[model samples]
Target: MSDVDQSQLFEFLCRMGDNTLVLGHRVSEWCGHAPVLEEDIALANTALDLIGQTQMWLGLAGEVEDKSRSADDLAMLRDVWDFRNVLLVEQPNGDFGQTMMRQFLFDAWHLAMLKALTGSCDDRIAAIAAKSVKEVQYHVERSGDTVVGLGDGTSESHRRMQKALDLLWPYVGEMFVADAVDEAMAKAGVAPDPATLRDAFDARVEAVLTDATLTIPDGGFAHKGGKTGFQHSEHLGHLLTQMQWLQRAYPGATW
Candidate 1:
C-alpha cells in the first residue's frame, strides 16, 4: 500500500475505535439509573465490552500511525469533528427503550461488520475483530431480546419502543456507505467492504424486529454524515467536552 493509503487506514481505525469508546462512555452513564437492576447490569457489562474493544482498536491504530499516544490519548483528546464513528452510536440514550433500540440497531450492524473484518488482510485488525466478535455477538443477542420484550410487551411499552426505533432509523444509512478510504483499504484486503455486510445486517435486524412485532419504518429521509468527513450531531460536541476535559486539563497526568 502507498503511504497515503496506510495513513488513511490508520485514521480510519482510530475513527472506529473512538466511536466505540465515546459510545461506551455514554452508555456507562446509565449504569445505576436503568429502569431495572438486571438491565443496569446488562448495559454496564456491554459498556465494558465496548470500551475493551475500543482499547484494542485504538492501540492498533496508534501503532499503525507510529504515534506514541496511548489509546486513552487517542480517545480523550480528539475533537468532535475528528471523530469517525457513525452517528447512530453517539445518539443520546433518551430512555431505556431508546437505549435498547439504539443498541439493537448498532450491534446488529457491528456484528456484521466485525464478522467480515475477521478475515481482513491487516492481521492486527483481523485479530482484534476475531477477539471482539465473541463479546459483540452476545451484546447483539441481549439487546435484540430486550427490544423484542419491550416492543411486544404492554401497549405503552410497544409504543415507546417503536418510537425509539423510528428515531434511530434515520441514522442507519451512514454505516454502510464505503468511501474512498474504505475502498482503498478494501482493495488491499486490509478492510472489509461494509456494503457487503448490509444484506446480512438487514436480515438480522429484520428478524429481531419481526419477532418484536415492530414495523420497520419506511422511506424516511435517512439522515447521513459523521463518517467520511462530515459534521456530527450536536450531542457529540457535549460528549467530547465532558470526555476530554480531564485529558486536556491534566495533559500527562495518570491516575
Candidate 2:
C-alpha cells in the first residue's frame, strides 16, 4: 500500500477506536447510577461491548501504523488533541432521558456504518464490523425502545425526551460529514464513505422519532471540529483523566 493509503487507514482506525472508547467510558459511568438494576446491568453490558470493540479496532490500528503502540496504549496514553472521536460521544450524560437520546442517535449511525463496513474490501475491517454489528444491533434496540417509551409516554417523559433531542440533534450531523481520511479510505476499499450513510441514517432516526411522537429539530447548526482532533468540548479531557489515571500511574499494570 502507498503511504497515503496507509496514513488514511491508520487515521480511520483511530477514528473508529476513539469513538468506541469515549462512548464506552461515558456508558460505563452509568455502572452504579442507572435508574434501575436492570438498566444498570444493560448499560454496563453495552459499555463492555464498546470497550471490547475499541480494543479490536485500535489493535488493528496499531498494526496498520506499524507503531509499537498497543490498543491499551492508544486508548489510555493518547492526549486529548490526538483523539478523533466525534463530539457527540463525549457529550455529558445529562439525565437518563438525555443519555438514552444520545445512545439512540449514535446507535442508529453506528449500526448503519457497521452494516456497510461488513462488506469492506479489507478483510480485517469486514471481520470486525461483522462481529460488532451484532452487538450494535442490541444497542439500537434498547436505546430505541427507551426513546419511544419516553417520547410517547407521560408529560414529564415526553418533555424531557424532546429537550434531550433538541440539545443533541446538532451533533448528529458530524457522524455523516466526510473528511480526507474518509475519502482516501473509501477509495482504497478499507471503509465506507460516511457521507453515503446520511440518507439511510436520517430515515432510520426519523422512523424511531416518529414512532415516539417526537419532532426532528429544524436547526441547521451542526457542530464540527472533532474528527480533525480540534475538539471544542472539555468533557473529553476530563473523561480521559479519569480513564487514563490508573494506566498512567501504574504503566502496564493489569488485573
Candidate 3:
C-alpha cells in the first residue's frame, strides 16, 4: 500500500478501536447496576474483553499512523465528529432489555466481521481479529440467549424486549454500508467489505430472534453518519465530555 493508503488504513483502524473503547466504557458503567448478579458478571466480562480488543486495535492504529500519540491520547482526545464508531454503540442503554438487544445486534455483526477479518492480509489486524473472535463469540452467545429468554419469558418481558429491538433497528444500517475507505482497504486485502457480512449477520440474528419468539422490527428509518462522515447523536458529546474530562483537566496526571 502507498503511504496515503496506509494513512487511511490507520485512521480506519483507530476509528474501529475507538468505537469499541467508547462502547466498552458505556457497558462497563453497568457493572454494578445490572438487574441480576449473573448478568452483572456477564456484562462486566464482555466489557473487559472489548476494552482489551480496543487496546490491541488502538495500539496497531497508533503504530500505523506513526504518530507519537498513545492509544489513550487517540481515544480520549478525539472529538465526537472525529470518532468513527457506528451510532449503535453510542446509543443510550435504555433498559436491561434494550442493552441486551443492542449487544445482540452488534455482537452478531462483529462476530461475522471478525471471522472474515481473521483472513485479512494485514497480519496485525488479522492477529487482533483472531484473538478477539473468541471473546466476541461468547458475547454473542450470552446476549443472544438472554434476548431469547426475555423475549419469550412473559408478556411484559416480551413487550420490553421487542421495543428494545425496534428502537435499535435503525442504527443497524451503518454497520453494513461500505465507503471509499473501506473499499480501498478491501482492495488491499486489509479489511473485509462490510456488505459481505450483512447476509450472514442477518441470518444469525434472525434465527436467534425467531427462537426467542421475537419479531424482527421494521427498519423504516436508517440511522447514518457516525462512522464515515456524518454527525453523531447528542449522546456522543456527553459521553466524550465525561470520558475526556479527567485527562483534559489534569494533563499528564496519573493515579
Candidate 4:
C-alpha cells in the first residue's frame, strides 16, 4: 500500500475507534444512575463491550500508523478537535429516552457498516468487523426494542421519545457523508462508502419507528466535521475534561 493509503487507513480506523470510545464513555456515565437496576447493569455491560472493541480498533490503528501510541493513549490523550467521533455519539445524554434514541440510531448505522466491513480487503479490518458485529447485533436489538417500548408506551413516554428523536435527528447526517477518507477506504475495499449504508439504515429505522408509532422529521440537514476531526460540538470538550482529567493530571501514572 502507498503512504497515502496507510494514512487514510489510519483515519478510517480512528473513525471507528473514536465512535466507540466516545459513545462508550457517554454510556458509562449512566452506571448506577439508570432508572432501574436492570437498566443500570445493561448500560454498563454495553459500555464495557464498546470499550473492549475500542482496544482492538485503536490498537490496529496504532499499528497501521506505526506509532508507539496504544489504544489508551488515543482514548485518553486526544483533544476535542483531534478526535474523530461522529457528532451523534458525543451529544449529551439528555434523558433515558434520548440516550436510547442515540443508541438506536447509531446502532442501526453501526451494524450495517460492520456487516459490510466483514468483507473488507484488509484482513485486519475484516476480523475486527466480524468480532464487533456480534456485539452490535445485540446492541441494535436491545436499543430498537427500547425505542419501540418507550415510543409506544404511555402518552408521556411517546412524547418524550419523539422529542428525543427530533433533537437528535440532525446529527445523524454526519454518519453518512462520505469524505475523501471514506472514498479511499471504499475504493480499497477496506470499508463501504458511507452513502452505500444509508438504504439499509433507513429501512431498519423506518421499520422500528413505524412499530413504535413515531414519525421521522421532514427535510434532511446533517451536521458534519466530527469524524474528520475538523470540529466537534461543545459537549465533547466537557466530556473529555471529565474523561481525560486523570490521565492529564497524573501523566503516565498507572495502576
Candidate 5:
C-alpha cells in the first residue's frame, strides 16, 4: 500500500476503535446505576464487549501506522480532539430510554458494518468483524427489544422513548457520511461503503419504529464531524478528563 493508503486505513481504524471505546465508557457509567440489577449486568457486559473490541481494532491501527504506541497509549493518551468517534456515541446518556435509543441506533449500524466487514479483503478486519458481529447481535436484540417495549407501553414511556429518538436522530447522520478515508478504504475492500448500508439500516430502523408505535421526526438538522479528529460534542472533553486522568497523572504505572 502507498503511504497515503496506509494513512487513510489508520484513520479508519482509529475511528472504529475510538467509537467503541468512548461508547463503552459511556455505557460503563451505567454500572451499578441501571434501573435494575439485571440491566446493570447487561450494560456492563455490553460495555466490556465494546472495550474488548477496542483492543483488537486499535492494536491493528498501531501496527498499521508502524508506531510503537500500544492500544493503551491510543486509548488513554489521546486528547478529545484527537478522537475520531462519531458524535452520536459521545452524546450524553440521558434517561434509560435515551440510552437504549442511542444503543439501538448504533447497534443497527454497527451490526451492518461488522457483517459487511466480515468479508473485507483485509484479513485482520474480517477476523475481527466475524468475532464482534456475534456480540453486536446480542446488543441489537437487547436494545431493540427495549425500544419496542418502551415505545409501545404506557403513555409516559411511549412519550419519553419518542423524545429520545428525536433528540438522537440528528447525530445518526454522522455514521453514514463517507469521507476520503472511507472512500479509500472501500476501494481497497478494507471497509464497506457507508452509503451501501443506508438502505438496510433504514429498513431495520423503520421496522422497530413501526412496532414501537413511534414516529420518525421530520426534517431535523444532522450533526457531523468527529471522523476528522477535530470536532466533538462538549461532552467528550469531560468524558476524557475523567477517563484519562489516571493515565496522565501516573504515566507508565503498572498494576
Candidate 6:
C-alpha cells in the first residue's frame, strides 16, 4: 500500500474508535443518574459495549499506524484536537429525552456503517464490523423504542423529543459528508464512502421518527470539524479533562 493509503486507513480506524470511545464515556455518565434503575443499568451496559468495541478499533489503529501506542495511550493520552469522533457523539447528553434522541440518531447511522463494513475487502475490518453490528443492532432497537415512547406518549414528552431532534440535527450532517479519508478508504475497498450510508440512515430515521410522531427540522446546515480534527466544540476539552485526568495525573499508572 502507498503511504497515503496507509495513513488514511489509520485515520479511518481512529475515526471509528474515537466515535465509540467518546460516546461510550458520555453514556457512562448516565450511570446512577438515569430516571430509573432499569434505564440506568441499560445505559451502563450500552456504554460497556461501546467501550469494548473501541478497544478493538483503536488497537487496530495503533498497529496500522506502526506506532507503539496502545488503545489506552491513544484514548487517554491524546488531546481533544487529536480525536476524530463525529460531532454527534461528543455532544453533551442534555437530558433523558435528549440523550435517547441522540442515541437513536447515532445508533441508526452506526448500524448502517457497520453493516457496510461487513462487506469490506479488508478481512480485519470486516471482522470487526460483523462483531460490532450485533451489539449495535440491539442498541438501535432500544434507542429507537425509547424515542418512540417519548415522542408519542404525551404532549410534554413529544415537545422535548422534538426539541432534541432540532438541537442535534445539524450534527447529523457531518456523518455523511465524504472527505479525503473517506475517499481513500473507498478506493482501498476498506469501506464505503460516507455518503453511501446516508440512504440507509435516512430510511431508518424516517421510519422511527414517523412512528414516534416527531418532526425532523428543515435545513442543510451541518457542523463540521469534529472528525477531521480541524476543530471541536468547547465541550470536548472539558470532557477530555475529566476523562484523561487519571492517566495524565499519574502518568503510566496501571489499573
Candidate 4: give its CA RMSD in angstroms: 1.0
Query: Positional deviation of 19 in candidate 6, in angstroms?
Result: 0.2
Summarize candidate 3's per-residue lDDT along 194-247 as a digit string, tens digits: 899999998999899998888987645779888874788899898888878988
> Lowest lDDT 10-mer window, candidate 6?
1-10
* Tens digits of lDDT, candidate 6, 1-255: 343487889999999999999999999999999999999999999999999999999999999888798999899999988999998999999989999998998999999999999998888889999999999999999999999999999999999999999999999999999998999888878899999999999999999999999999998999999999999988888889889999889999996
Per-residue alpha-carbon lDDT of candidate 2 for residues 64-172, written as tens digits (9 for 90 to 100): 8997889988998889999999999999999999999999999999999999999988889999999999999999999999999999999999999999999999999
Question: Which residue runs does candidate 1 get wrong by more than 4 Å?
Answer: 1-4
lDDT of 1 at 117: 86
> What C-alpha RMSD separates each model from the true structure?
1.5, 1.3, 1.3, 1.0, 1.2, 1.1
TM value for model 1: 0.96
Clashing pairs in 5: none
Flag regions of model 6 displaced more than 4 Å. 1-4
| Residue-wise C-alpha lDDT for candidate 5, range 123-202, written one tens digit per residue | 89999999999999999999999999999999999999999998999988888889999999888888888989988899
What is the alpha-carbon lDDT for the whole of candidate 5?
0.92
Candidates' TM-scores? 0.96, 0.96, 0.96, 0.98, 0.97, 0.98
Which sections of candidate 5 miss by over 4 Å?
A: 1-4
Q: Candidate 1 lDDT, tens digit per residue, 123-225?
A: 7788999999999999999999999999999999999999998889999888888888888878888777778888998999999999999998888466677
TM-score of 6: 0.98
lDDT of each: 0.86, 0.92, 0.87, 0.94, 0.92, 0.94
List residue ranges in candidate 4 displaced over 4 A. Answer: 1-4
Q: Quote the positional error of residue 187 for candidate 2 in Å.
A: 1.1
Error of 3 at 255 (Å): 3.2
